[model samples]
Target: MAAQTETVQWKLGEQLYQNPLSGEHDVSDFIMEGQAAISFPQRRMRMENVLDPKLGQQANFVFWCPVEFPDSIAISWDFWPIREPGLCMTFFSAKGANGEDLFDPSLAERTGIYPQYHHSDIHAYHVSYFRRKEADERSFHTCNLRKSYGLHLVAQGGDPIPSVQDAAGPYRIQLLKWKDEIVFKINDMIVFQWHDDGTAYGKRLEGGKIGFRQLAPMIGEYANLSIHALERG
Candidate 1:
């Protein structure tokens, strides 16, 4: 029997029930109730999270957004870090026909696992997206600007952006598809594009739940407080 695909939708002021797969943490610590809103001029919803220093062992939070992609997916958000020298965001997903785990790598390779470094003054702003290929395969991509650190943006098989020498502040990221082409932008500046020739995943599976993440080893306070999903036409 073929697996069934589920489509989930959320509107302004609607609350997404925190799923048990939300890991072993309390839902109240990660997501803020009624914090998601829509931006009229941009025609897109905005998800925001403000970090509180007194929650959990670390000062960062994680949440999951359930989505079904028919043709493509696009995500945009604004991030600002209170400090200046730590990883700000790391995105993750579950890839498979029935949302099974396939690309499970060691904690070192996966960006979310906390590192053993300590810095109280680090901060970052990031945006990213992924293209599903099969049940066990997917392609990952991201663009980010850091304060007190150079901004880095890289596509699959491309070199990392040379470290910038100045601090960048409050950048917006947009990911969208124009026909069969995928594009990535930072503060409205187009930085990367690729043709959808169906080569996103080399040989793994595809099609499953997508999510947002913050890179671990983060000190100080950070939050992925609000998240939502919708199907694209």
Candidate 2:
């Protein structure tokens, strides 16, 4: 028999969710952790942790998308900072440590706490794009990329988005992961780029789920969430 090469079709990635962030979407559409609330304050999906800011760490919460995405995909969304002095993080490539589905009943239940996702049962890569939550973060603005199962700060770069006072935006944020390289950009300006050498934190993480996390008291509004595939080289 003659040897043949395999051919594959490449198309723009299938959109997982393009929510208007409006009230029309059901609350049942997402998996919630802690005390996160979704309200269409102005017909756009606005998420804010109901826990008081003074609650500090306990005030943090996460909202996970109902879909699992492939590795070589581009995750993009529009963000507006409604209230400041809060932190924002997006967790992706997440799954149970034992290779089980993220929602497998056998896994430990998640309660919107930080440790549950990082120290306990799940493994993921979370990026903080707008980090004005603390005194130090306000003085120095930067975007961070972290891999977890343990908090390993792999990359850091400047954050260009202005504070809520001077902001007039539905800022475009994008994170692109192709093979071992991950790049983050805001408004087309490259923030940080890192290549996983596969020696640290086991190996390059593969496909998993994505979630939105916020440190309470910071009301952030998001819309037009999407994921698209890149042509693999």
Instruction: Give one clash count per candidate, in the order shown.
Output: 19, 2
lDDT of 1: 0.32
Model 1 ranges off by over 4 Å:
1-62, 90-94, 97-169, 177-180, 200-207, 217-233
Please list the residue runs of candidate 2 whose C-alpha ends up more than 4 Å from where it truly belongs after superposition: 1-17
Give the per-residue lDDT of model 1 (tens digit) for 101-201: 42323211222222311111111222332212122212232343211112323243221222122323334544443334444555566655544333332
Q: Which one is best on TM-score?
A: 2
- Per-residue lDDT for 50-110 in model 2, tens only? 7777877788889888787887888888889999888899998889987788898999988
Every candidate's lDDT? 0.32, 0.81
Clashes of 1: 19
Candidate 2 least-lDDT 10 residues:
1-10
RMSD after Cα superposition, model 2: 6.7
